[model samples]
Target: MKRSTTLISVTLIFASIFSAGSRGGDALGKDSAGSENPMRRFLIEDGDPNLSAIIKHIDNMYRSKSSTSRLKLIVTKPRNTRTLTMKTWTKGEEKVLVIIEAPPREKGTATLKIEKNLWNYLPRIDRTIRIPPSMMLASWMGSDFTNDDLVHEASFHKDYESSLVGPSEDPNGWLIELKAKPDIVGLWKKLEVIVSEDGRIPLVSRYYDRKGRLARTLYYSDVKDFDGHIIPSKLVLIPEDKKGHKTELIYEDIDFDVPVPDRTFSLSNLERKK
Candidate 1:
């Protein structure tokens, strides 16, 4: 089946912290780190040097300096299943475009994010809707995904206060938790990420509601090499309140730090028919 984009911003903002809590990928191996590394640049608490490095790598999964990818989104609810393929283009923290490529109904459907704002274009409606800041974290225009690709992109280092909550020997990975800091905007009150010391892949991530209830759980596996870097190509998210409801994102292709055009991030381009 065809895949989707981080564009799951057309798109999934993710699948961000509040993305992994964005569809995800494991970006680096234990030996390396990149400049756009989120954890390294914005670490709130410095406890374990090794833990901090690992945390940075996790954010890199979504906050890649600039990236392009073919993503496949499979949303499975107890009632039905919907699948879509999206092509996404992103440039650092500035811009992103996600276009639906299949299921003719959704083809040409897209979302654009520039700076911190979001817009959605519906081919059928022939309209461009500016996703309000208050609603950006709420839902996708056409799919069940709640994280906007833009919201997902800006999340991670930008939205939360991070700390190594504590080390868990039972889980065999450092437990990293994120809470919304003052002025930071997001839907989850808390998030927990588990990264295995044995590998570069994050084993699991849990997103919590404002009241501290477990809202959802994300599982990452199928670790594979994309280019020279090692990352997980598959991410599965299950919502706690919604029984049998899940979203799965698979990375069919991804290249980080590619060239991008700034104009593509504009509202004018978003509404222009392609």
Candidate 2:
């Protein structure tokens, strides 16, 4: 396929729906009376009492303040499959630039994300197009992961109300369930995440729809040291009903707390090589 055709076809898959948000992370605050929170009534605080700690670790696992990574993303759908090799530089959740580096056809194609605004650069046309709100939920780069995941529109800590699923559902690992706040928007109605108690490594996350039906599951595996921090190097997302469809993101290399130039997030740099 021609380079332009490939880009067009891949982008079209994500046109169904989306929005992008920038920052995340929220700490527990005092209730209205500055005392006990009413939500805590339904949560576990007896045995583990580590609900807050788990939430904090999960929220901060992937990135520090700034990071750079070489990622290999693979997507498979029915009769088609595609692999993309991209280099991503991120300054927190708000500022990010992902540039396709391999498969020559998409060499200069890049996406710049700053806050809620997103822009896509098409090197073939030498143009930068601002992504509209309607496209925020679209599959990003033709992967099952949406643009929302890319930009972090909803914070896992703030947007969702979390509670420990209790010891009955928890054995060797911690099981935390999160329900989206009324104001937040996304396809998932609730999410159940399992992480190791000691290593804080994510094991599995099940996404449920509004009706409480399983939508998809994200599996994390292959723990390795990315410099000083240990984290899962591979994440695979599998749909509940889609038999042959799944997306995998593998971190070839990652450097947390890496120095990112102040100007690296600018629009003009979208088409510029690092």
Candidate 3:
């Protein structure tokens, strides 16, 4: 009788241990599921109170001093034509001004301010016309890039919700894909931004049109150290529909945090600056 009692007690203890182990395993599996979901992680991480580093990095990139560049714009469809020389200056995210020096017939300077303000200082007409937001999607100086691309320099963190799409590899380095929130205001309906895991520089971005088609592919190449941060010296914009045509922007000179006068960003400056 004593032996049977002892055996029964041992069996009950073993069963309890087995039950506890099973419950613990189930809990761990649930935790794993939450971590693996990219959307869930993005929402939680984006809401982190400490986002100063990301914000500062974006601000420094957009608010820098003038950057001179030579842009070669190719239009493939009607004919394989190209525009040779161009120079650009950016005064923060609010203003971007470009001057085209070559192809005398089409040569002129255009200044684009944020939102609804824009002007083209046509040496030919010697007049300025205010551009509206509806025309933002129009080709920029006959290039593949739209006017909206120039003025919409808002930081991704501020304008869109970001999520890690899991570990992936790209030409640049280890990458994590980030999808923009549906309600975010921007030209692209969705964006797949490839960011280097080590450097945190955005490498390649695939932009989808409003209908969810892959409309454009933007590759950030020739990364150079500007000041203390790494910036892409060249950005190549290629439209999927326009085969054989690409816009390559080569940054010749760049400076950051320089004092830009208030007048530089004004609409009057756009019209007056020859």
Which residue runs does candidate 3 get wrong by more than 4 Å? Answer: 1-62, 65-78, 104-108, 112-115, 137-143, 265-273
lDDT of 2 by residue, 123-185 (tens): 888998777765665544434555544444445677799887853344357778999988887
Query: Considering every candidate listed, which one attains the maximal TM-score?
Result: 2
Give per-residue CA lDDT, model 1, range 1-274, as digits (tens). 0122224344535324213313333434322333344534333234443555555666665555556788887878788788888778876555677878877877998877666666677778788877666565555433334654335554445577787776667467678788877785556788898876542568898888778898778888787665544677788878777777777888888776566767777777767855
Per TM-score, what order, best first? 2, 1, 3
lDDT of 2: 0.63
Comparing 1 with 2 on TM-score, the higher-scoring candidate is 2
lDDT of each: 0.63, 0.63, 0.48
- Clash count for candidate 1 is 23
- Clash number by candidate, in order: 23, 7, 0
